[model samples]
Target: MRLEQWSRIMGKLAIDDEVLEEVAAAARSRGVSSESLAQELLLEGLRGHKSKESLRQLMEAIAAMTSRDVEQTDSVELLREDRDR
Candidate 1:
């Protein structure tokens, strides 16, 4: 942990009263400040969102790499001709 991490920056956050109460209760239960708990939750949400975005990009790249164009062909005639040989 860094010394700057423990220092609070000057900013105001607007939160609903009910949500604030819930956060306060959770912080009390965990023996940490409500601000710290809120910060941790926000960080977790950001990480999860980034992971989902990375997975989506990877899937799109894989699809593009494996995609191919197909040409029309006479399947029944080709099979019959092959069987006769």
Candidate 2:
């Protein structure tokens, strides 16, 4: 189920005193509501993880790649010659 398919709804969450204090401090530092701070923090943390999954999927497609798909960027022969000098 995706968000766009839903009727927009506000959900409830319960935070402990310790967690709420951290949120409050973050909110003050960022000049935003604790709710906004929490949402931003959640998105920031989760977005990187979500992109890594997509990147892993893209990398998996390399199983079908031929030699032409590879672009050699290393200087193995140059390094070996330089080393023998």
All models, RMSD in angstroms: 13.4, 9.8
Give the worst 10-residue stretch by lDDT in candidate 2: 1-10
Residue lDDT tens for model 1, 1-85: 1223334452556666788788879999999987788899988988767577889998899878753685546799899999999
Reference-based lDDT, residue 78, model 2: 77
User: Model 2, stretches more than 4 Å misplaced?
Assistant: 1-9, 50-85
Task: For model 2, name the residue pairs that clash.
Answer: none
- CA shift of 34, model 2, Å: 1.0
Q: What are the per-residue Cα lDDT tens digits for candidate 2 across 1-85?
A: 1222222433555556687778878899988876677778888998757577788887878755647668765699779989999
Q: Give the C-alpha lDDT of model 2.
A: 0.69
Give the local distance difference test score of model 1: 0.74
Best by TM-score: 1
